[model samples]
Target: MSSDRTLLMRPSPAARESLSALTPILHRVVERIGETNDITTLALEPLEPPSMNFRCGQFNMLSALGVGEIAISMSSAPHERMLRHSIRDVGAVSHALCQSSVGDLVGVRGPFGSDWRVESARGDVDQRDTVVVAGGIGLAPLRGAVEELVRDTQRGGGRIFILVGAREPSQIVFRADLESWKARGAKVSLTVDLATSEWDGRVGLVTTLLADAGFDATNSRAMLCGPEVMMRFTARALIDLGMDPEGILVSLERNMQCGVGWCGHCQLGPLLLCRDGPVVPYAGLVSQLLTQRER
Candidate 1:
């Protein structure tokens, strides 16, 4: 990563030990929320006291017994007691997880990978702005960071701007949280690729909103999560506006079969996303992002 970027947090000793073991800690699903037609949020309670401590942008390996396991981002804030994962039913494992009922046992391992390190965005002066860009279900991974940013802004730290884009108004996840964040003073903007008759929001690529967004490009930090194509374009747009590439971060997704680095399934260029990233500075990924074919 770039010298200007914050170092990725290493897993704690307890997390490291947990990674060495393959067995998952079983948790019971306490609540299931339908965020959209395809996306669902599962709130889990540990069978024992919670020992896993995760930062924003970290992910957990969730297993649906007799099916398979998949990587899901933590959609709830770290300060929250229950563990929440927003899953999109894209495959067998995810579908099984989404179909899980209350009181069902789900296997969970790891609060792994790198983190968003939102605190670093506030430099010595602590007045730097935070710009968050999300596309489709990408908002799920960024929820924790957004919650922290909102609280910081409430404490009179700095400004926060959230720019989100989805396929349509109906596909927007965390609809209630978006309203609450806006009401709590974060500058929130919504856009869609397609619109309905009742829709009144902007209709265009999320990058288009950057021009009118009130933030200091030179001093602000940006965090983006979305499809590879969307993130590529958004990162480039931020660079064109004078933000340092090191100040821009992106969350990547891959076929992460193993939460540890032992498996090479999730390699992206020189980094193993399962261990080295999920969150990484854009400066280090520029070449790879430009050349690698999207999966």
Candidate 2:
């Protein structure tokens, strides 16, 4: 354990090179599965795997050779060999990337930005209980974290409660995974903004579920990912429930042109969302998060 901590304190040269943003490696699409009307999950096999590893909330910039490039978060956990991305087709780059067949090559430029801090949260003896709040496709980035928590729960590491919300029942991704996590002793709650006749579950905004999530706000860590508005409101709600502002983390989305900090496209205040964040604590982010760009 001491050696591991020492290694973390001083990353090797190869590890640093693996995290370089300027280079883009060629990754082949091994499989593509549709998640919803607009979302698709793509499995990419890298030509040469990087020496460095990625955390749960980190993202990669994927480029369709002829089209364009866009940022997508990995839905798979770090221990997983294949890089999995759950992307919603909101533009040309994302659509083109998702349209690839079994053996198409694409450019992968990252594993960038901050993480959900699940390790730090779980490692803290006082903060063993975790609260995960996600909405819509925002669940993509949080999925890896949730899986880790589930594994931890099985080993008696900590208790995790997942609260997810989507537009409707059909829009919920990883439904089976949620059930599996629940069966494994993790508490999972889901809600939708609108429901069909086939649905008999809760129907409302995700924040409403917080009242019954069964987590101790004062002693727990909360990680949120979703539309900016939803994250903002959810953070506020957690604060009201006595969660420390520093204990509340939120992932932000922006126009990230370059995977590195060179591009000013994703800058918010003095921090570049591509480099300094994507995942940031709520403690000192009031001004930047409340800014117009966040909305």
Candidate 3:
């Protein structure tokens, strides 16, 4: 095993052209919700509507030119195109994005991506089952789907359960929304990798939380978004609990350039992650793809 540490820095690639429906977003930070460590929620908006729209779970690559571009998921729905990016100040672009003050100008690109199958879940709710597993900012993708499920009645079949795990309680995203969800009777279970005094929540990995949540794996479909390690383990756990492999949706993150898949930047072996899937069935990934890091 390599002992080298992973470095956090901005990618050097030039920014690609933003889609026709997108534009430079000039807005203000109406609110800032800091959780801990440098992860914070920024409620920023554009002075005007984005030329384009995106499905839930799609992401935009935001850039500050020399600062670099980072893919951030849109936490808001289509109607509220006003963008909300939950940023962790980990690298140059991210740090720049987070350091900006109210009313700063930023560039936004296509709601580029292979969107999560939130649409498929529609009208599928009666006696339907749904499960979401997220780690750290992994929760970003799931948040949109959860909101869709909670509000969209066409999907009246399934009961929704969210199992989220973070490094520590402070690293958790959507803290206020979590309480609001609970108050509104949504089922959410949380855990953490490391404990801090501020944490009174469950202590353990997300897999453990999944095991105890008592989901009917046979009928429930699961969406897992997290680091590769967590997503892999979570998929195995779900299968062991009797969920069908085909029923689980996973987002494979790779370096994405042409979000449309032509550039091949986000290819996963034979599959192009940006086009074929950022969301895909676990069964579809080739064994070699699952086992190796991309060259």
The TM-score obtained by model 1 is: 0.90
What lDDT does model 1 reach? 0.85
Which parts of model 1 have CA positions greater than 4 angstroms off? 1-21, 121-126
Which candidate has the top score in TM-score?
Answer: 1
Tens digits of per-residue lDDT for model 1 on 1-295? 2423211222345664554236567678999999999999999986666446889999998989779888899999888877899999998999999999999888788888999886754443246799999999999999999998888786666898999999999999998999999999999999999999999989999999999999889989999999888888898899999999988889988889878899899888778998988998899655365458646
| Candidate 2 to native Cα RMSD, angstroms | 7.2
Q: Candidate 3: lDDT over CA atoms?
A: 0.71
- For all candidates in order, the CA lDDT equals 0.85, 0.82, 0.71
Superior candidate under TM-score, 2 versus 3: 2
Structural similarity to truth (TM-score) of each candidate: 0.90, 0.89, 0.84
Per-residue error at 141 for model 3, in Å? 1.9
Which candidate achieves the best lDDT against the true structure?
1
Clashes in predicted model 1: 0
Alpha-carbon deviation at 245 in model 1, angstroms: 0.4
